[model samples]
Target: MAKFRLLPDEQLARSPFKQLWREFSRQHSAIAGLLIFSLFFLLVLLSAVLTPHDPYLQNDSLLLLPPSWSQQGLVQYPFGTDDLGRDLFSRLLVGARYTFGIAMITVMGALVMGLLLGTLAGMTKGLKSSVLNHLLDLALTIPSLLLAIIIVAILGPGLQNTTWAIMLALLPQFVHGIRNAIAEQLNQDYVIAYRLDGANNWQVFSRIILPNIWEKLTLMATMALSTATLDIAALGFLGLGAQAPTAEWGAMIADSLDLIYIAPVSVAIPGLLIFLAVLSVNLVGDGLRNAAKKRREN
Candidate 1:
């Protein structure tokens, strides 16, 4: 039989996140994904400073220059110039900022809001928990992407609006998952012991329930981040995300549609980056999921 093994406070205090990371290190694909994402994140952080040309700097004279390896390419523009003569390499780098930044913002916002409501729902008994659970279930009945689209459509377009829409869409998942996890925690021996000892609900919840569920919450966060990024890309592709002139991957793809035949790199570059970003994050999330499963099985 599997047993609950809550470690002593002294051991738990000494690097919990590091312990989670150690479990992650055991998975090969997860490690590869972490490396890939770390590299990509570092590149995004350095995009503005490392790239030679300004993302917004454009000229008609250098329009549609192919990548430098091609015979028609210019030596100065490594990833070539777009139809508007903007440096594709610079724009690609800059696009990462908007893509990654928006996803992070949305995920964090949703997580915080979800944690509050979910915690409240999980901690309460009888009618309150039932009501919150029903509402969450109703919300979850709507497909995430479709829900996001509906919210974005109602709120109108643009990046911030799109982000808020995505955030709203993610809230139900967090509420459902966290509520269940906390409910499970509430039934555990440690929680019962705390209650017997006259520990208040807030005391047991804050000191015990939240810490034990941190691993699950982290997994949810990574998965939500990937979803947020992909949703942003989808919305941007539809012209409902970041507006024109902004270097966002989805917006870049939209801008490149007209030049698809003439300069395929325009579309391909952004698409590939989006694919890689989504893939890496998904891999990392999968690793976290597996680790959680292993912990349970033991």
Candidate 2:
């Protein structure tokens, strides 16, 4: 009798989470980015519990206090006081909340709009595609910052208006990307087979197309989040977003500009938070792309 050998267990294959973790671990920059972002996120989430004082409370006596290292120093303000004598550290924490909140809302809104438009345009041919494609091109050609400024200027500056401006600026790029991805998948044999089985368009999209395109969608969402965060900060810096005493990172930086020499920490804290937040998002995007590529190869 021939000797029988047992086949290797399929269950022993690497899990998705394991694969992702392994891939992410090899990316040092991505890991560093993740840590920095986590710190900021934690600071935001625990602001009420962690802050040394009410972020809005004014202490005129401590106004523009220099950092601990300065000669006039070792003051009660750890990161020094802003122009209004609000604790820079406390404001920085609240600023993280504002920045992250705006970014999340804008990204989510744009993702929803883009996915619907892209799906409709990609699945249909001829006139529908042509109309959408042209519209997307027109939107894409306008610089996001310029478009946002124009829209916000018309609508007047407020949180809701800023969110809308961000969505408008970001939606077109996501629409284009999703459309291209769907169009490419449409040519695959599996998609063609599904269509031939008398499956409805909605059925095919929900069951077949959406699952296959999730990776790309995730990547796009990450990029959109990063862009939205930066854009919101920029608007705040320009005095068109969040407004005064709102504890937004950009607005904090703007408020601290004149005191840069007197209290560098006031500017540094918020600026650092903004930089780390954007950097984390970008690193996460890169990691996702690398992981997806590896998955496809396997």
Candidate 3:
């Protein structure tokens, strides 16, 4: 009998997660983005406990105070006070909960709904699929923010309404992307083999289709998350999202517009937070897409 030899660790197959990480780790910007995003997520989780003062509490005497080290600043307020004299640091910490939290929820909701609808459109025949494609095209032609604004205008402005509006506006992009991906995959040789091998639509989709298209789906998710974050901020800035006393970053910026010359830090801080959040998400998405492309080429 021939002797069998064990394969070396380097020659062994790595799990998908490990493989993706191996690819992703090579990108320095992705790692930095992940770190920044984690920091924002941590702030969201710890907002209630980490806040130095009640985000909503007002101190008329402390209005427009600068950062703690500034001549007019107080030790109790590290980032300073807003026009309402509320602790800027505290409100920003709490604001992460509203801004990032809402975007996360909206993206997830859109993803799930889009996946279902896209699958339906992809697996169906001529007329139904054509109709869906047409509808999706119409939705896509309208800018997401514009679509969201239209929805919010009809629903009446509020945080909850904003979330719903963003989710709906985002739905078309996810649906369109996923539908195209599935359509492309369906034309592959392996997909035909699966069909010939008696695999049902559900089985093919859940197994081969999903596994092959997962990278695309992930890229779409990250992009959607960034879009949702920006859309929420825009709506809030327009006074149509988070209402008064909400501590949302967009609303905070809007609230501080009048103080731009007098207490610019108040507006700048929130604007910076929004910029950082969007930038980090986009960086991670770009990194993932690059890594996935590399993996494919290899």
Candidate 4:
């Protein structure tokens, strides 16, 4: 029988994931952001059960009610009702599904497509790479939000259309960032050594380049998620996404603009949610960037 001996704590090697976690946990803002994101994610998962009232159900008598804590407010309408008498709390809860959900879907799609396209562009040279690079550069010159708007304009407004528009708008940036990162890695001496040692393109990319660029990819994905969330909300605000009767945050804000004076809380709550969502994701990204930088330095 073979006997295995456990290494002492000082001699034990931590896994890369563990090392990354250790670094990530040290950042206070990142932890806070992670907590907030977890809460939002939970809300997205449980909105149907968590909401006290149907988000789309209208109650004429309950129109524009203030928050429950207010003297005139009803306990049943906590967080109050919107101008259309829809429960603000319920709508906001469900809105997470639309906002975070769409953002997630778009980012994921963009990330996958970007990776394949970027890897292809990075691995190739001469006219093929140049053409791809120039196209991405042209796309980059157009602001992502503006590009989304143009796409949405042509595709017509709605949630599904909005998702495709945002994904398309985001694809170029993702491709550009990933391509640049891969190109940088390919230029390193280690890559040259690998090639000289008979490592093929797929082997070099899969075994070396992919591992090295993961941190950058993660950071890019986080940042892109924030942008996607904001863009979705912006499109909703402009009446180009989500549409009516949906409990989306931006549409909720748009529906209540007329009552900003009568029920400022209605507008403020959804806007606050959007702000927090964007802020939390950004804080987490910043934390990741800092952690990765420190990890690299060490």
Q: Each prediction's Cα lDDT score? A: 0.89, 0.83, 0.91, 0.90
Query: What lDDT tens digits, residue by residue, belong to model 1 across residues 103-124?
Result: 8888999999999999999888
Task: Compute each candidate's TM-score over C-alphas.
Answer: 0.91, 0.91, 0.95, 0.94
Query: What lDDT would candidate 1 get against the real structure?
Result: 0.89
Candidates 2 and 3, the one with greater TM-score:
3
Summed over model 2, clashes come to: 0
lDDT string for model 2 (148-232, tens) is 8888999999767888998999989989999999999889999899989998899988999898898899899988888899999
Residue clash pairs of candidate 1: none
Best to worst by TM-score, what's the order? 3, 4, 1, 2
What TM value does model 3 have? 0.95
The top-ranked prediction according to TM-score is 3
Sort by lDDT, top down from the best:
3, 4, 1, 2
Model 4 agreement with the true structure over 1-298: per-residue lDDT tens digits:
9997757432323455565676789999999999998888888789889988888899888878899999999898889888778888888899999998789899999999999999988999999999999999999999999999999999999999999999999999899999999999999999999999999999999999999999999999999999999999999999999999888889888888888999999889889999999988998999899888876665
Point out where model 4 deviates above 4 Å. Answer: 1-14
Regions more than 4 Å wrong, model 1: 1-19, 296-298
Summarize candidate 3's per-residue lDDT along 80-173 as a digit string, tens digits.
9988789999999999999998999999999999999999888898898899889998899999999999999999999999999999999999
Candidate with better lDDT, 2 vs 4: 4
Q: Predict model 4's lDDT versus the native.
A: 0.90
CA RMSD per model (angstroms): 4.8, 2.8, 1.7, 2.2
